[model samples]
Target: METRKLGDSDLEVSAIGFGGWGIGGAPFWSTEGDNASVKAIRKAVDLGINFFDTAPVYGFGHSEELLGKTLKPVRDRVILASKCGLRWSREALGAISKNASRTSIEEEIEASLRRLATDRIDLYMVHWPDVHTPQQETLETLVDIQRKGKIRHIGVSNYSIDQMKEASRYGKFISLQPEYNLLSRSIEAEVVPWCLANGVGIVAYSPLASGVLTGKYDKATRFKDWRSKGVIGTFQGEAYERNIDKVERLKALADSAGRTAGQLAINWVLRQPGVATALVGVKNERQIEENVSAAGWAPAPEIDARLNEVFARE
Candidate 1:
């Protein structure tokens, strides 16, 4: 697999990183079993994927636990990246809230370390923006942690350009993990340009638009989890139909390139400027194999232009 420097940091991760959101066993994502997830994680590493991304809130620590158990033997071989700042109460197990205060971050890091079974994290990130907590305070706490060698580098996820700038005052953000796919281009207008100019690498999550770009669904298709509840635009009624139509055309393009639609979608994101890696969520070994095929593959300029035209259409 291809490797890229994460922002300006010394850490160089694989172009295709394994995203642990699905393996976490969250009801919204659903899952098969721990054994299956374990097999998938091992398969990903064996296939040359050196970057693994997870979060404490993913299954409320379940994801980190699984990742830790599966990768502990190969810990030194992979770049372990996890996030903080999202917390849930014991009383309300599934209900999570953003809490990035100095105390909250300080406490969350300890728990994450314990769950991941590692003394130090290669890259630690603030999972979400907390409105009540100042960016300076949060970044300062991370800086202190990095100073202690508990974390190698600091990054942020789901942050706006202003927040990235504000956090950079306290510590240089090495990376930004955000949702960016063919269907979700909201970040391209500003966040992407700003990151590219400022030397912040982008780790694009949901590059397949939560599977909408895979050409696996149709009007009669319905997901078993909360995704079927229509909370996300791509999973909703009219938008779902529109996206499916686009995926069909995209599949044709993928066919000509001898790749699956999912691989094509991932390749599109990987080819974008400022993208260091594409974090793909996988459950079993087959899924990881399919996703890893996207690495280092770039479509022709004319094909890319046709893809843009498809996105441009209604």
Candidate 2:
């Protein structure tokens, strides 16, 4: 429910933005149904969430369509965000690859517009860094479209400090969307500092450590989805076991504090400096309501410190 300026941009995004990945639901996640997803989005808005972030590859465009139609009536009141760069040869998740090329973006923007049923995207981002393409090409292309009014602001996701440095030389970005949470704080030492110094806001993704921080999984729980494929984040081997150990400690501490693990996780991410918003992917109305509640509250100082110690990786 708390709104903050995204980096240096004038766009006031909610502290808890609606992450559209889960609603898309396919190779990555399962969903109740399209009707449930639509209801979830509306529920988020009713609860004061105004920023919605999605990508073309999310359900291979299903997410955009659902968001486009569901939020059409309240378009002016909310901020719609979508990403390019990560493209797929087919509808399958395995076929997805990074392609931030000029031609690819030009083609992608048009398609996204059509699917989203909007003339301009509030925030357009490169989903991931395309090492093969020059940073200038991607940034300039975004700038060109910015001038043409296709996207209101430019952002980069899953980018490293070095990658951001290279990309910033060409054009300014208002935000950096990185994986930040209790179990994942790699950005704390560098990326967070860089964003604060450069005047870029941090939009954190996977704030719940992909549900591990929600206290629903254990060391024995093996994910059958993309988490097992080593695509992103820590989900296999001894590393996962260590993460689970920390999560267990976090769960106990969060429970004693009279808060759900998910709420605690989201609150911690929002408290971090340089973070403008924390994106929570919801699949139903209940989920959105819970996530939105995390926005206006915080744990006591002692509980917060205990949580930090529980999930500290460094």
Q: Give the best candidate by lDDT.
A: 2
Clashing residue pair totals per candidate (backbone < 3 A): 0, 0
Q: Write the per-residue lDDT of candidate 2 for residues 1-314, one digit (tens) a residue.
A: 78999998899999999999988988888889999999999899898899999999999999999999999999899999999999888777789999999999999999999999999999999999999999999999999999999999999998888899999999989999998888888899988888999989999999888888787888888888778888778887898888888877777877887877788899999999999999998899988887777777778889988887777757
RMSD of each: 1.7, 1.1
TM-score of each: 0.95, 0.97
Candidate achieving the largest TM-score: 2
Clashing pairs in 2: none
Off by over 4 Å in 2: none
Question: Cα RMSD for candidate 2?
Answer: 1.1
Candidate 2 residue 55 Cα shift, in angstroms, is: 0.3
